[model samples]
Target: MLRAAFLASTLVFSVVPVTAPPPVDSAVDCDYYCDDRDPSLPLSARRSPHRPGTSTPPAPAAVVCNRYCDARDPALAPSNRLAQTVVVAGRQVSLRFDDTDAMGWGAIAGAVQPGDEVWLDRSFDAGVSWGAGSRLGDTAVPPGFGDWRTMMFNVDDWAGLGVGLLRACGRPAGSSTIACTSWYRTTWNAWDRRTAAATALMQRYNLSTGLFDTTGWWNSANALNAVIDNIRLTGMTGYRYAIARTYDLNRSAWQGDFINDYNDDVAWWGLTWLAAYDLTGDSRYLATAKAGADHIFRFWDSVCGGGIWWSSSKNYKNAIANSLYVQLNAALHNRILGDTVYLQRALAGWTWFLNSRMINSSGLVNDGLTSTCANNNRTPWSYNQGVPLAALVELHRATGDPSLLTKARALADASTTSAFLNPGGILFDDGGGGDVPSFKGIYVRGLAALNRALPDRPYTSYLRRQADTAHARDRSSADSYDQPWAGPFQRSDAARQHSAVDLMNAAG
Candidate 1:
C-alpha cells in the first residue's frame, strides 16, 4: 500500500519547508553586517554590534577562512558546487566548496528577487546544531540582481579536526518564514565514505563473542549477513574471517546451534548462513542453514489457518516470520539438488501467505494478523515490504514462474516510490532505537536480492540514490552512520553501521 493510504500513527514523513524553525527573533530588529574583523577570530569576538542578545551564539571557535570573506562567488566555478536544494517558489540554494582554498559559501538563484536573502549555516557536528540562523555571510539581494551569495567561510573548524556541514538558507523579503536546503558534507567522497563506514563497522566486531558488539542476536545475524554481502559484492577479502568466526562462536552460544524460540531470529541466522555458503561454497555453512531452517519450520502449525507463529509462545503470527519462512524454504529448494520436500513446503507457505489477509489493499503488508485472524493493520515497516520480494524472487527461480517476478516488482515499486517509505527519494525510518535501527538494512538486502534475480535490473538507480545520500549526509567523522540516511547524524552503533554497509553493497 502507498504510505498515504496507510500511514503509521508514529513516524510520519512529510516534506515541510523548513527542517528547523528559526530561533526566536529578539524584540529589537538588528542589522547584520560583515566587518573588517579577522575571520580567524572566534565567532563571539567577531559578532556584529547589533546582533541579538537572545540568540545563543555557537561555541567560541575561530572562523577559519581561505579567501577574503566577500571575494568572488564560488558558484562561478560550477565544478566547486557540491549540492543544492529548492527552498520555495523555485528558489535554489546551492552549497559550493573550493577544495584548494578550503572555503565554502551558499548561493541562491532561480527566481531571485530584490528582497531575497541568502546565507550559510555551518555546523561542526554534522548539522546537529549551528549558530542562531544565518549569522555568517548574511546578504540581502539588491535591485536588478539575478542571484545572491553569502561570503566564503571555512569548511572546517579552527582546529581542522573535523569536516563541517554547510547548507544554504534563505528568506524572501517581507516573509517571516525561512527555508534551508539539506546539509552537504564538506569532504564529500562516496567511495571513501563507503570504505570508512565498512572499516569502522569491523572495529565494532567482537572477536571473542563472534558477533558485532552493541547490537542484539537477530541484529547480529543481519549485520553478519551485511558483512558477508559486502565481501561477496565488493570482493573485499579483509573481513572474510568474520564469516566463519561468527558462525563458530555463536553457533554454540544460543541454543547450541543458532536455534531459539523466536522463528524470525532463526530465519535471520538461516539466511545469514545461506549468504555465507553462497560466498565461500562451504558445506558447513549450507548444513547449518538447513538445520536452522528445519528448526524454524517446527513452529509452523494450523494456527492462523496455516502460517507459522511468530515465536514459541504462539502469541501472534506476523509478516516478518512468515515472509522469511517462505524465502528461506524457497531458497533452500533452489540450492539443494532434487529437493522436493523443501520445494513443496515453499509452495505451501507461499499459498498460505497469499491467502492470508496481512497484505493490505495497497499492496503493502501490515505487521500481522489479529486475534481473530483478521489483518492487524499495524505499521507496514520497510522490511515488511522487503522480504516478500525476496521470497517471490526465490519462488520464481524455483518454479520458473513469470508471475512471481510481476508480484515482486509491484511491491518494490510501491516501496521505492512511496512517500512514507522513501520520502524525498531517501528511505525513511524513525530509528526509535533498539532493533528498529537494523530494519532498513534488511529491507535493502531483500531489495538487492530481487534486483539480482531480475533480467532488467530495475532497482539499480533507486538503490544507488539511497547509498549516495547516506554516504554524503548520514555519516559521522569516525565513519559511523545513524538511522536517518538523509542528514544530522545522531548516534551510531553496530546495527546502524551494518545497515549502511548493506546499502553500499547494494549500490555497487
Candidate 2:
C-alpha cells in the first residue's frame, strides 16, 4: 500500500506557471525528521542496496538569470538584449539589462584595492530606487586590525578576496583568464591563491573544527583557519563530527555578537567546502559533507512548516540555509551514497518548500520568512530568492520532476518581474532600497549553475547575454582590476559595522 501511494504521488508535471494566490498554511508530512524520529536507526543503518530497474531519476530544473533574463525553452531561441554597466568598487562594471540583472552582490566587489570603500547603509529604503550611496560608519571592527588596511594585513580578508577572485574569473560573464588584471582572467591565473589562503586561515585558527565551538574555540579568523587545516590534513571525518560542531557544537557557545550563531555559519562554510570538493573531487571533503548532512537531517525542525529554523532556537526559519543544504546534498548525492535515495531526500525537502515556504499573497515565494513572521522581521531577500531558484534547478535534474521545474520558472519570473528590484536590475538591499552589486554576481552564478544542470533548456542564452554585458563593462580596464587603495575612508566607521568580511567572502 505504501508503495502504491508513493508511486501514485510520482507524477511528472510539465512547466506550469502558478498564478494562484499563496496559501496561508500548508502542512506536508514526509517524515521530515525521519532520520531523527528513529534515533536507534542511523542513516547508514537504514540503507538498503539499490533495487535494480526501479526507474531512471528525473532531470535537473532550470532557473532565470540576474532577474531580467528568462530561461528560454530550447525549442525557442532567446533574444540577447544587454544593458549598461554600473560603477562598483570604484570602476564601471557591466550590469546586464538592469542592475540586479547582471551579477548581484558580487557586482559590487572587484579585485582587492588599497583604498576601496565598503559601503553600509542602515536606513536603506527598498522602494526608493536611487539615492546617494550611504557611507556606513565603522563603529565596530575585528580586533588586531587597527583600521581597514588592505595591504598592511598579514592575512587577506576572505570576504573581499572571494569577490575579487570571482570577478577575475569573469564568472558574472565567463572568462579564460584566472586573475583578471582587466576584464578577463586566464584559467591558469592566480585566482585560487587567496582562496587557498583563506581556507588555510580559517582552519589554522581551529575555527572550522567540530561543528560547534562553545568556548569560542575557532572564533577569530586566525583560529578558525587552524581548524580548517586539521580537517584538510586528516582524511575528511564523516558526518557526526562535522554536524556536532555546526549544529550543537557551535550552538553551545553563544555570545549574541551576530544574530546567526555557529549553526548558521556552518551551513555557509560547509557549502564552501562542498564546492571545493566538487571542483577537486576530494574524498575527505565528501566525507565531511555526509557528516554535515546527517546532522541537519537529525536536528532539522520545521519551525516555519516549509523550512528549517536558523538554529535550535525558535528564531525564524530561513530559506537560504535550507536552500544551501539542498544544493549541497543534491550535488553530493550520487558521490556520497550508493544510489537515488539521497536524491529522494533532497526531492522531499524541495517538495516541502513548494508546499510551504515558497508562497506569498500572490502564491509566489515572497523571499523568505520575515522577522515579523513570528517575531519582528522583514520579508524578501534577493539571496533567498536567487539561491533557491538555483537549487530547484538541481532538484529538477535529480528527480526529473516537472513540478519542481515549473516552480523554479515561476520564481525566476517573479524575481525579475517583481517591483522590489531596481529598474537598473539590482536587488533591493534588505528588501528595502539600495543597489548592492554583489547580489548580481550571486544571481549570475546561480543562473549559470542552473543552465549547466539543465542543458536541454534554452536558458543558457539569456544567462550568456548577461555575462557578456558584465564582460564588456570591465573590458581591458586594468584600473578596475587593481587591488583597492588604503585611506582614512578605508577604515572609516561605516565599513566595520557592516561586517565587510562576511559579505566580501561570498562574492569570491
Candidate 3:
C-alpha cells in the first residue's frame, strides 16, 4: 500500500554482460538452486543481447526482455507494477514488481546517502532461504543522491515453470543492521494469505506458558479462540497443540479455572474454552466453561436494576461485562443438555439488558451505565457493540426467537456501516495501548456469528473488506498486523494479531 509518491527519481544504468555461469545442477546445487529451473541465473545466461561465448562481443545494450529480464531492464514499465514499502533504518525500502513482465526489483529512499544499500531477494521456497537469486539487483546510493534502486530481475522461473517469492532488503549507510520486507508471492490467493497470517499469529505463542507472548491474560483467550476458529475454518491442524497447552497451563491461574475479579475477563476465557470443546470435544474444556459461567452469574445483582458488575468491587455496571455475561450463559445453555437453569438465566439477563437503555438511538451499544443507572453514553467501543450481537445470536438459538436475530441484524448493520466505528468499510479502533487493541476483533467475531445464523449472510462483503484491507495495508513486512486495517503499520503484538486473525477467520 505504500504509494508511488514516496519513490524518488529512478536511476537507470547498464552493466557489462558477463559469461554465463555453468548450468546449475539441481541435485548437487540444491542448497542454492532448489529446483532444476532456478531463476537465479544472470541475465546473460538467459537473454543477453550478446550471447555468451560469442567471439565478437556485442555492444552492451540497455537490458530489455519480457518475462525474463536483467536487472535495470529498460523494458520494465512503472505503470504496470505492484509495490509495498516498509520503513527500515529510518528509510523507505520497497519491493516492486511488474507482473506483466514477471519482473521485480528493490528501492530505497528518504535521507538517502552514499553507502545506503538496497537489494532484492528471490526465493524458490517461501522465504525460508534466499536461494541462488538472492541479492539480485543489489545497489547502493551514490553521494548526494536522494534514493536508489537495483536493476530488474525476473520474478518467475527461467521457463515460467514457477513463481518465486521476492522481498526488498536494505541497510543504512553506517549501520551493520539489515532489514527486509515480507516475502511477496504473486500467486498467493486469499486463502494463502490467511494461512500466512495464522502462521504468523502462532509464532507469537509461548508453548511453555500456553499463552501468546506480548499480550495480556484475557487477550490470550481471544487469541486462542481465533486460532481455534482458524483451525475449524481452514482445516489446518498444525496449531492444535495450543488448545491443550493453553488449557493445561492456565487452567489453574488466578483462583483456579480462569476465574478472576473482572467478570468480562473470566467470560472471555469461558467462551474460548467452549469454542475449544466444540473443536476438540474436550470434556475438560466444557466443564471449565460451565464453571466460569456459573461464577460470572454470581456477580449479577439488583444493582443497575440487574446487570453484572464489571469487577468484584461492584463499583460500576458496564455494557461489556453484562453483554459477555449474557453471551456466556446463553451459549452454555445451547451447548448443555437439560439446561433449564442456564436458559432462564440467559433470558432474564437478556430482558434486563434490553430494558437497561445502554443501546443508543443509533443502535450501537454504549460503554456502560452511569452512576445513576442511566446510559453513560461513553464512546461506543467496538467490543461493546460486538458482544451483544453474539449474545443475541446465542439467545435466538436457545429460544428460537425471531426477534433476537432481528435485533442482532440492526446492531450489525449499524456497526458495519457506521462512519466512525467502521470508516471506509474497515473496522477502526486505536485501542489506546490497553484492552482496546482486542476490541475490534471481538466485534468482528460477533458480527461473523450473527452472519452465520442469518440465511442471507448480509455481512459477507463487509467482513471480506476488513480482511482484505488488513492483509494488503495494515500488515507489517513480517505479516504481523497492527490496529488500523487501512495502512501505515506501526507496531504488532498478540492483541493486534488475534484481532486481525479473527477477521481472517470470519472472512475465510
Candidate 4:
C-alpha cells in the first residue's frame, strides 16, 4: 500500500489564489489565528488510484451569485440603462442594472470612494412612472448602512449595512476606500428596529418575577435566551436586575431541580448565564452556570452508553442538552473561571454525541437519540442543527483541528439548503407555531458565530439577503414583524419578534 501511494504522488495541480469577496470575521482567522482561505483552492477529492496524469479534475463549482436588480421601469431594457464607472478600492467598477419590476426589493453591495454616486431610478407605481435620486459625499451611506464606527453607542434610524448598501466615508474625513478596513463593514442588520422590537417584547411579555410570558406561558429556555440577548444588546442594569429576580423565583437549579424541569431547558439557561458572566463580569452569573453545569452532569451515566438525559428523570437522551454541555464547559475553560474538569467533560460529551449518530445524512443533525440509543427519525429542527453546529465550532477552536471545520462546513452547507434556507438563502424552516417559529433565528445566530470563526461571502450574503427581505417584506405598519421572514405580517408575538431580533442583530 505504501509503494502504491508513492506512485500517485507525481500528479501535478495548478494553484491559483483568490481573495475572499466579503470580510472574514476577525475573531476566527483574520485577527488572531489567521487561517487565510483562498477560494480558488481545489477540493480535496482524490484524482486517481492507478497512475499520475497530466490532466487535472475540474475544480469544484464556484459559489453561485444570484443576479437581481430592482428597477422602477420594467419596460426599459438593461442595455439601454446607463452604466456609470466609479473608482472603488482603486479599481474602476461598473454599477450595472437589469430590467426588473422589483422596487425596494433587490439589493446591491460594494465599497465606494468619496465622489462615487449610487443612484436609484424609482417608480412608485407603474413602470412608466420613473423618478431618480442620488446620494452624495460621505453622507452617501446607503439606507440601512452598517458602519458602527461613526455612530457607535449612539441612536440612529439609519438601519444597518445590509444588502444594496454602499460604503460609508473614510476615516479622518477624505479619501474613503472600502478596500481593507474593518471599520467599513457591509452588513445586513436592523439593530435599531430589531433591538427596539426585542425591548418592546420584553416589556410586554415580562412578568414581575423576571420570566417572560412570551406568548401564553413562560418557557424557561426561551426566557433565558431573551435575557442574554437583552444584556448583550443593552447591558442595562434593569435587565440584570430581572435576571437576578428570576433566580430568586427559581432558585432550585443548584439543588438539582433546574428552572424548567428539563435538562436541555436548564442547560440553555446555564449557557445564557455563562454568556451573561462573560459580558457583565459578575461572579454570580458564573456561579449560577457552575451550579447548573453540575446539575446537568448529574444526568450523565452509563444509560444509552454515554449521554445526558432530556430531564433529571433519565427517560431519554437528546442533542441540545449534551451540545450545550460541550459549549458551556469549553467556554468555562476558556473564559475567566479556569477549570480543566469542564474541558475534560466537554470533550467526552462531544465524543458521545458524535458516536450516537444523531447527525443524519445530508450533513444535518437530527433531533435526538431514540430510546434504543439510535438517532430518532424526528424532523430536523433549526435549533437542533444550530446548537450542535455551534458546539462543533467551539470544539474546533478548543482543539485546533482543521477537520472540525470540515464537519462544520458540511453542516453549514446543509443548513443553507432547502431544508433550512430559502432559494435566496434566507433562513427558512417550518414555522409550525409554538417554539418552531423561533428556531430559525437561533440557527442564524449560530451561523453568524461560525462566520466569525471562518469567513465566507456566501454565508454573509445569505444573511444579508434575509435581512433585506425582512426589511422590505416582514415589517408591519406598527413596526412589528411576523414569523415567516418571506412575507407580510401574519401573526406577531414575543418569541417570533425575539427571533427576528436575533437574526437582524447577527446581520452585523
- For residues 259-347, write the lDDT of model 1, one tens digit per residue: 76678878998989998899899988889889988888888889777988877667788999999999999999888999998888888
Instruction: List the candidates ranked by lDDT, beginning with the highest.
Output: 3, 1, 4, 2
- C-alpha lDDT of all candidate models, in order: 0.71, 0.35, 0.73, 0.50
lDDT of residue 442 for candidate 2: 43
Worst 10 residues of 1 by lDDT: 1-10
Write one digit per residue (lDDT tens) for candidate 4, span 175-218: 43322100111111223555444543443333333344323222
TM-score, candidate 2, is: 0.43
Ranking according to TM-score, highest score first: 3, 1, 4, 2
60-86: candidate 3 lDDT, tens digit per residue: 122334455566563445534545777
Candidate 1: Cα lDDT at 481 = 80
TM-score of each: 0.63, 0.43, 0.67, 0.58
Tell how far residue 479 is off in model 2, in angstroms. Answer: 6.4
Clashing pairs in 4: 108-164, 144-160, 145-160, 145-161, 146-161, 161-187, 162-187, 162-188
Badly placed stretches (over 4 Å) of model 4 are 1-191, 205-207, 216-227, 230-241, 248-260, 419-424, 431-433
lDDT of model 4, residue 383: 77
Instruction: Report how far residue 21 has shifted in candidate 3, in Å.
Output: 38
